[model samples]
Target: SFLSIAIGQETPYKAVVVTDGHQALETVTHVLVDLLLLDYTLPTMNGIELYDQLHAMPGLEATPAIIFTASLVKHQDVIEQRKIIGLGKPIELDELLSTIERLIA
Candidate 1:
Protein backbone atom coordinates (compact mmCIF):
# COMPACT_ATOMS: atom_id res chain seq x y z
CA SER A 1 0.00 0.00 0.00
CA PHE A 2 2.82 2.38 0.76
CA LEU A 3 4.48 1.62 -2.56
CA SER A 4 1.22 2.10 -4.41
CA ILE A 5 0.54 5.38 -2.68
CA ALA A 6 4.00 6.70 -3.37
CA ILE A 7 3.87 5.84 -7.08
CA GLY A 8 0.36 7.22 -7.40
CA GLN A 9 1.50 10.51 -5.90
CA GLU A 10 4.51 10.70 -8.20
CA THR A 11 3.02 9.59 -11.52
CA PRO A 12 -0.07 9.18 -13.69
CA TYR A 13 -0.04 5.44 -13.23
CA LYS A 14 -2.35 3.63 -10.82
CA ALA A 15 -0.47 1.04 -8.84
CA VAL A 16 -2.08 -2.17 -7.53
CA VAL A 17 -0.42 -3.93 -4.65
CA VAL A 18 -0.69 -7.72 -4.38
CA THR A 19 0.55 -10.00 -1.62
CA ASP A 20 2.03 -12.73 -3.78
CA GLY A 21 2.37 -14.06 -7.30
CA HIS A 22 -1.07 -15.71 -7.15
CA GLN A 23 -2.85 -12.51 -6.28
CA ALA A 24 -0.68 -10.66 -8.76
CA LEU A 25 -1.80 -12.94 -11.56
CA GLU A 26 -5.42 -12.76 -10.50
CA THR A 27 -5.36 -8.99 -10.26
CA VAL A 28 -3.74 -8.47 -13.65
CA THR A 29 -6.12 -10.90 -15.26
CA HIS A 30 -9.04 -8.81 -14.13
CA VAL A 31 -7.52 -5.34 -14.10
CA LEU A 32 -5.86 -3.46 -16.91
CA VAL A 33 -2.26 -3.47 -15.73
CA ASP A 34 0.09 -1.43 -17.91
CA LEU A 35 3.26 -2.42 -16.12
CA LEU A 36 4.52 -4.75 -13.43
CA LEU A 37 6.77 -3.73 -10.54
CA LEU A 38 7.45 -6.82 -8.48
CA ASP A 39 9.44 -7.44 -5.32
CA TYR A 40 11.72 -10.48 -5.12
CA THR A 41 10.61 -11.56 -1.67
CA LEU A 42 7.02 -12.44 -2.52
CA PRO A 43 5.35 -15.05 -0.30
CA THR A 44 4.86 -18.05 -2.58
CA MET A 45 6.93 -17.58 -5.71
CA ASN A 46 9.87 -15.28 -6.34
CA GLY A 47 9.50 -12.25 -8.61
CA ILE A 48 11.28 -13.82 -11.59
CA GLU A 49 9.11 -16.92 -11.46
CA LEU A 50 6.05 -14.74 -11.24
CA TYR A 51 7.18 -12.82 -14.28
CA ASP A 52 7.36 -16.02 -16.28
CA GLN A 53 3.84 -16.98 -15.23
CA LEU A 54 2.47 -13.55 -16.06
CA HIS A 55 4.12 -13.54 -19.48
CA ALA A 56 2.77 -16.98 -20.22
CA MET A 57 -0.71 -15.58 -20.27
CA PRO A 58 -1.92 -14.90 -23.78
CA GLY A 59 -1.40 -11.33 -25.05
CA LEU A 60 0.55 -10.34 -21.92
CA GLU A 61 3.95 -11.55 -23.07
CA ALA A 62 5.01 -8.10 -24.20
CA THR A 63 4.10 -6.28 -21.03
CA PRO A 64 6.98 -4.45 -19.36
CA ALA A 65 8.28 -5.53 -15.95
CA ILE A 66 10.85 -4.56 -13.35
CA ILE A 67 11.92 -6.94 -10.62
CA PHE A 68 13.35 -5.56 -7.36
CA THR A 69 15.83 -7.62 -5.43
CA ALA A 70 18.65 -7.29 -2.92
CA SER A 71 20.60 -10.16 -4.46
CA LEU A 72 20.23 -9.19 -8.07
CA VAL A 73 23.43 -10.87 -9.11
CA LYS A 74 21.94 -14.26 -8.22
CA HIS A 75 19.39 -13.92 -11.00
CA GLN A 76 21.27 -11.66 -13.40
CA ASP A 77 21.48 -14.17 -16.24
CA VAL A 78 17.76 -14.89 -16.43
CA ILE A 79 16.93 -11.24 -16.05
CA GLU A 80 19.23 -10.34 -18.94
CA GLN A 81 17.92 -13.11 -21.18
CA ARG A 82 14.30 -12.08 -20.57
CA LYS A 83 15.19 -8.41 -21.13
CA ILE A 84 13.56 -7.41 -17.87
CA ILE A 85 15.23 -4.79 -15.73
CA GLY A 86 16.54 -6.05 -12.38
CA LEU A 87 16.53 -3.05 -10.13
CA GLY A 88 18.25 -3.62 -6.81
CA LYS A 89 16.26 -3.18 -3.64
CA PRO A 90 16.44 0.11 -1.71
CA ILE A 91 15.88 1.69 -5.11
CA GLU A 92 15.91 5.44 -5.31
CA LEU A 93 12.42 6.79 -5.88
CA ASP A 94 13.61 9.09 -8.64
CA GLU A 95 15.40 6.30 -10.45
CA LEU A 96 12.34 4.05 -10.21
CA LEU A 97 10.06 6.77 -11.51
CA SER A 98 12.42 7.53 -14.36
CA THR A 99 12.64 3.88 -15.30
CA ILE A 100 8.87 3.55 -15.25
CA GLU A 101 8.49 6.68 -17.35
CA ARG A 102 10.98 5.36 -19.87
CA LEU A 103 9.28 1.95 -20.03
CA ILE A 104 5.77 3.32 -20.29
CA ALA A 105 6.68 6.13 -22.66
Candidate 2:
Protein backbone atom coordinates (compact mmCIF):
# COMPACT_ATOMS: atom_id res chain seq x y z
CA SER A 1 0.00 0.00 0.00
CA PHE A 2 1.90 3.04 -0.33
CA LEU A 3 0.21 3.79 -3.58
CA SER A 4 -3.26 3.55 -2.09
CA ILE A 5 -2.41 5.76 0.80
CA ALA A 6 -0.79 8.29 -1.44
CA ILE A 7 -3.73 8.25 -3.81
CA GLY A 8 -6.19 8.71 -0.98
CA GLN A 9 -4.30 11.73 0.28
CA GLU A 10 -4.03 13.25 -3.15
CA THR A 11 -7.50 12.62 -4.51
CA PRO A 12 -11.05 11.87 -3.48
CA TYR A 13 -11.09 8.56 -5.35
CA LYS A 14 -10.87 5.39 -3.30
CA ALA A 15 -8.39 2.71 -4.29
CA VAL A 16 -9.63 -0.86 -4.38
CA VAL A 17 -6.83 -3.36 -4.25
CA VAL A 18 -7.14 -6.91 -5.59
CA THR A 19 -4.58 -9.61 -4.93
CA ASP A 20 -4.54 -11.11 -8.39
CA GLY A 21 -5.92 -10.86 -11.88
CA HIS A 22 -8.78 -13.24 -11.14
CA GLN A 23 -9.87 -11.18 -8.17
CA ALA A 24 -9.60 -8.06 -10.25
CA LEU A 25 -11.82 -9.59 -12.89
CA GLU A 26 -14.39 -10.60 -10.31
CA THR A 27 -14.38 -7.20 -8.69
CA VAL A 28 -14.86 -5.42 -11.98
CA THR A 29 -17.83 -7.63 -12.78
CA HIS A 30 -19.69 -6.13 -9.83
CA VAL A 31 -18.30 -2.60 -9.84
CA LEU A 32 -17.77 0.21 -12.26
CA VAL A 33 -14.14 1.32 -12.08
CA ASP A 34 -13.10 4.78 -13.20
CA LEU A 35 -9.56 3.71 -13.90
CA LEU A 36 -7.35 0.66 -13.65
CA LEU A 37 -3.82 0.47 -12.25
CA LEU A 38 -2.55 -3.03 -12.94
CA ASP A 39 0.74 -4.69 -12.26
CA TYR A 40 2.18 -6.65 -15.15
CA THR A 41 3.27 -9.64 -13.08
CA LEU A 42 -0.06 -10.52 -11.55
CA PRO A 43 -0.77 -14.02 -10.24
CA THR A 44 -2.95 -16.48 -12.24
CA MET A 45 -3.27 -14.34 -15.35
CA ASN A 46 -0.88 -11.55 -16.22
CA GLY A 47 -1.89 -7.92 -16.65
CA ILE A 48 -2.16 -8.02 -20.41
CA GLU A 49 -4.47 -11.02 -20.31
CA LEU A 50 -6.62 -9.34 -17.70
CA TYR A 51 -6.69 -6.13 -19.73
CA ASP A 52 -7.80 -8.03 -22.82
CA GLN A 53 -10.60 -9.66 -20.89
CA LEU A 54 -11.73 -6.39 -19.34
CA HIS A 55 -11.67 -4.62 -22.68
CA ALA A 56 -13.92 -7.32 -24.09
CA MET A 57 -16.56 -6.54 -21.53
CA PRO A 58 -19.29 -4.07 -22.55
CA GLY A 59 -18.74 -0.51 -21.33
CA LEU A 60 -15.10 -1.13 -20.46
CA GLU A 61 -13.39 -1.25 -23.81
CA ALA A 62 -12.27 2.35 -23.54
CA THR A 63 -11.35 2.37 -19.88
CA PRO A 64 -7.98 3.96 -19.34
CA ALA A 65 -5.38 1.76 -17.65
CA ILE A 66 -1.83 2.08 -16.46
CA ILE A 67 0.28 -1.08 -16.52
CA PHE A 68 3.28 -1.04 -14.17
CA THR A 69 6.20 -3.46 -14.10
CA ALA A 70 9.61 -3.84 -12.54
CA SER A 71 10.80 -5.45 -15.70
CA LEU A 72 9.40 -4.28 -19.02
CA VAL A 73 11.69 -5.91 -21.55
CA LYS A 74 9.50 -8.95 -22.05
CA HIS A 75 6.22 -7.05 -22.06
CA GLN A 76 6.86 -4.11 -24.32
CA ASP A 77 5.26 -5.70 -27.35
CA VAL A 78 2.03 -6.58 -25.62
CA ILE A 79 1.83 -3.19 -23.91
CA GLU A 80 2.18 -1.43 -27.20
CA GLN A 81 -0.30 -3.75 -28.84
CA ARG A 82 -2.86 -2.91 -26.17
CA LYS A 83 -2.13 0.80 -26.55
CA ILE A 84 -2.24 1.28 -22.79
CA ILE A 85 0.05 3.51 -20.79
CA GLY A 86 2.95 1.64 -19.21
CA LEU A 87 4.81 2.87 -16.15
CA GLY A 88 8.04 1.46 -14.75
CA LYS A 89 8.06 0.15 -11.21
CA PRO A 90 8.79 2.43 -8.24
CA ILE A 91 6.34 4.73 -9.92
CA GLU A 92 6.52 8.31 -8.74
CA LEU A 93 3.60 9.41 -6.63
CA ASP A 94 3.25 12.66 -8.51
CA GLU A 95 3.23 10.95 -11.87
CA LEU A 96 0.73 8.36 -10.73
CA LEU A 97 -1.57 11.01 -9.31
CA SER A 98 -1.35 13.08 -12.45
CA THR A 99 -1.98 10.08 -14.65
CA ILE A 100 -5.01 9.06 -12.65
CA GLU A 101 -6.38 12.60 -12.72
CA ARG A 102 -5.88 12.79 -16.47
CA LEU A 103 -7.43 9.41 -17.12
CA ILE A 104 -10.46 10.05 -14.95
CA ALA A 105 -10.94 13.56 -16.25
Candidate 3:
Protein backbone atom coordinates (compact mmCIF):
# COMPACT_ATOMS: atom_id res chain seq x y z
CA SER A 1 0.00 0.00 0.00
CA PHE A 2 0.92 3.67 -0.34
CA LEU A 3 1.30 4.00 3.40
CA SER A 4 3.81 1.18 3.58
CA ILE A 5 5.87 2.60 0.76
CA ALA A 6 5.77 6.17 2.00
CA ILE A 7 6.46 5.30 5.61
CA GLY A 8 9.20 2.94 4.57
CA GLN A 9 10.96 5.59 2.51
CA GLU A 10 10.90 8.21 5.23
CA THR A 11 11.30 6.18 8.40
CA PRO A 12 11.85 2.75 9.87
CA TYR A 13 8.19 2.42 10.73
CA LYS A 14 6.49 -0.95 10.38
CA ALA A 15 2.92 -1.32 9.18
CA VAL A 16 0.56 -3.93 10.50
CA VAL A 17 -2.44 -4.67 8.33
CA VAL A 18 -5.53 -6.08 9.93
CA THR A 19 -8.35 -7.49 7.84
CA ASP A 20 -11.21 -6.68 10.22
CA GLY A 21 -12.11 -5.06 13.51
CA HIS A 22 -11.75 -8.28 15.44
CA GLN A 23 -8.19 -8.65 14.23
CA ALA A 24 -7.52 -5.04 15.01
CA LEU A 25 -8.77 -5.53 18.55
CA GLU A 26 -6.62 -8.58 18.99
CA THR A 27 -3.58 -6.85 17.56
CA VAL A 28 -3.96 -3.89 19.84
CA THR A 29 -4.17 -6.14 22.85
CA HIS A 30 -0.88 -7.79 21.94
CA VAL A 31 1.08 -4.88 20.47
CA LEU A 32 2.30 -1.50 21.55
CA VAL A 33 1.03 0.81 18.87
CA ASP A 34 2.28 4.37 18.59
CA LEU A 35 -0.37 5.53 16.19
CA LEU A 36 -3.44 4.03 14.59
CA LEU A 37 -4.48 4.28 10.95
CA LEU A 38 -8.04 3.01 10.67
CA ASP A 39 -10.44 2.71 7.78
CA TYR A 40 -13.89 4.05 8.53
CA THR A 41 -15.47 1.01 6.94
CA LEU A 42 -14.46 -2.29 8.48
CA PRO A 43 -16.18 -5.64 8.72
CA THR A 44 -18.00 -6.34 12.01
CA MET A 45 -17.19 -2.95 13.55
CA ASN A 46 -16.77 0.50 12.07
CA GLY A 47 -13.78 2.74 12.73
CA ILE A 48 -15.51 4.83 15.35
CA GLU A 49 -16.73 1.76 17.18
CA LEU A 50 -13.27 0.24 17.04
CA TYR A 51 -11.77 3.46 18.29
CA ASP A 52 -14.21 3.45 21.19
CA GLN A 53 -13.20 -0.06 22.09
CA LEU A 54 -9.52 0.81 21.80
CA HIS A 55 -9.95 3.95 23.84
CA ALA A 56 -11.60 1.96 26.59
CA MET A 57 -8.62 -0.36 26.72
CA PRO A 58 -6.19 0.39 29.51
CA GLY A 59 -3.32 2.70 28.52
CA LEU A 60 -4.74 3.55 25.09
CA GLU A 61 -6.95 6.55 25.77
CA ALA A 62 -4.48 9.07 24.36
CA THR A 63 -3.30 7.11 21.36
CA PRO A 64 -3.37 9.23 18.22
CA ALA A 65 -5.46 7.95 15.32
CA ILE A 66 -6.42 8.90 11.80
CA ILE A 67 -9.70 7.58 10.39
CA PHE A 68 -10.18 7.53 6.64
CA THR A 69 -13.34 7.02 4.60
CA ALA A 70 -14.40 6.97 0.98
CA SER A 71 -17.94 8.12 1.80
CA LEU A 72 -18.94 11.72 1.37
CA VAL A 73 -20.74 11.90 4.65
CA LYS A 74 -18.52 13.32 7.40
CA HIS A 75 -18.89 12.25 11.00
CA GLN A 76 -17.74 15.56 12.44
CA ASP A 77 -19.46 15.02 15.75
CA VAL A 78 -17.95 11.64 16.34
CA ILE A 79 -14.56 12.80 15.15
CA GLU A 80 -14.63 15.70 17.53
CA GLN A 81 -15.97 13.58 20.35
CA ARG A 82 -13.16 11.09 19.94
CA LYS A 83 -10.53 13.79 19.38
CA ILE A 84 -9.14 11.96 16.38
CA ILE A 85 -8.02 13.17 12.97
CA GLY A 86 -10.13 12.30 9.91
CA LEU A 87 -9.08 11.92 6.30
CA GLY A 88 -11.02 11.48 3.10
CA LYS A 89 -10.56 8.34 1.04
CA PRO A 90 -8.05 8.08 -1.82
CA ILE A 91 -5.75 9.54 0.73
CA GLU A 92 -2.90 11.63 -0.64
CA LEU A 93 0.45 10.08 0.15
CA ASP A 94 2.03 13.33 1.30
CA GLU A 95 -0.93 14.20 3.49
CA LEU A 96 -0.97 10.76 5.06
CA LEU A 97 2.74 10.78 5.69
CA SER A 98 2.61 14.27 7.14
CA THR A 99 -0.22 13.33 9.44
CA ILE A 100 1.56 10.21 10.55
CA GLU A 101 4.75 12.14 11.16
CA ARG A 102 2.92 14.71 13.22
CA LEU A 103 1.09 12.11 15.25
CA ILE A 104 4.17 10.03 15.88
CA ALA A 105 6.32 13.02 16.72
Instruction: Give stretches of model 1 more than 4 Å off.
Output: none
Best-to-worst TM-score order: 1, 2, 3
Residues 12-105 of candidate 1 have per-residue lDDT tens digits of 9889888999999888878987788989889999988999999999878999999999989998998999899889978878889999999997
1 versus 2: better TM-score goes to = 1
Q: What's the true lDDT of residue 38 in model 2?
A: 92
Positional deviation of residue 84's Cα in model 1 after best superposition, in angstroms: 0.6
> Each prediction's Cα lDDT score?
0.89, 0.88, 0.86
TM-score (all chains, Cα) for each model: 0.95, 0.92, 0.90
lDDT of 1 at 63: 94
Q: For every model in order, what is the number of clashing pairs?
A: 0, 0, 0
- 10: Cα error in model 2, Å: 0.4
Residue-level error in angstroms, candidate 1, position 94: 0.6
Instruction: Say which candidate scores most in lDDT.
Output: 1
Q: What does candidate 3 score in Cα RMSD to the true structure?
A: 1.5
